[model samples]
Target: MRFTSHTTSADGITERDFVHDGVPGVLWTPGHDPAGLVLSAHGGGRHKRAPGILARAHRCAAAGLAVVALDAPGHGDRVRTAEDERFAIEIRSRMAAGQDAGALVAEYNALQASRAIPEWRSVLDALPALGDRVGFWGVSMGSALGIPLVAAEPRVRAAVFGLIGATGPLVRAAAAITVPVRFLLQCDDRLVARDAGLALFDAFAAPRKSLHANPGGHGDVPEHELAGAVTFLAG
Candidate 1:
């Protein structure tokens, strides 16, 4: 995963408001010229502007990577258009109706995932025209979402998973990925504790994988650890 750098200005914080499963998002490149693209996912209860993920996007793009900070189905601009106030409520409501919460979220995710991956991938597909390689970067819930993309997609040469070490869905993804991976978490993270995330990291089937811990809450991956993520994606 050799990522290059280039300068970029956010094309726009456009909402996929009109497109089916379209996610409103920011599209930007960090440095002078980018070497790759990072599909960014935010943490639980948060949207794509999450500080930690954005910080890494700075470094990645500075290193020449295009960044697409994703707005999960019920997040960002999408949250505004959601029939409900938030995705959690929507999930809870569906579950209350005897709908499988996980299945519903997965269905919602599946519908939106393809739209997103290709949005970022389209940037990557066009990257050769710009001269770069492409990959993904995600945190907390976003990292959880990245599991499927990393597992089944061959285009993903590298992945950065942080702020989240595990999830209910991740239990099944334990050995699904075969790509090089770098995982990070907070030691006393109330949101994602060291133990649980570590357990998930242990489940990775990648021949090459690494993990690091810092002191922080669930909201973001700390500044000190940002280098580690960039290093991982850069690796």
Candidate 2:
């Protein structure tokens, strides 16, 4: 990992920008030693520094946990490939025609994960600054990627995942994850069927897991749930 810039905020949180094997990422830390490390993944089409991600990072940092976020392939500074462009156009067309685009999204997410999981593992290998405890926070497309990562990575002890449904591969991945999980579901998410999301939650093999469902669309996760996640990941 190569650090490109570093800055400290008035509240004693330090932020750093870095590039690892061509992947652009950001890290935020409290001035003091962090109790643990949290890897944050942003929603599809959103970059590492999306408003919601930044809010969560700052809050986690204040709670003495270091937070790291990476711009997923075809997002932020990364160049989109022909496949990515094609998927974008197709999904837009399907949505405009009021057709179900879930399968397209699932396939796209799987492709992204094949590339992203290795990048995340490489970043973890380089980040010796992280303590023993590691957790993951991601939703929507983030969850699509994260479920597989946390399943394969024994280093990750806990996770926050949701805003996604039980695609076949994801359900299999979720079955492999035994870490405590906190899942958030938007009750009225237009993109994800409510029953599908519930089924995904049920697929997790973790002995300790909780589902938080609130009334809203995909983007409207309740504020309290955000606060609760900070507490959950911190502990």
Clash count, one per candidate: 21, 0
Determine the C-alpha RMSD for candidate 2 after optimal superposition of all C-alphas: 0.7
Each model's lDDT comes to 0.62, 0.95
Each candidate structure's TM-score, on Cα atoms with residue i matched to residue i, is 0.70, 0.99
Mind giving the per-residue lDDT tens digits that candidate 1 earns over 1-235? 1223333347422212122234355556543555666667775556666666566666776665667665665566664445434556877787678765555455444544454555555434443543444567776666666776677567777888766545555756648877888887777765455777888898889898888776756654566577766766665
RMSD (CA, Å), each prediction? 6.7, 0.7
Off by over 4 Å in 2: none
Pick by lDDT: which candidate is best?
A: 2
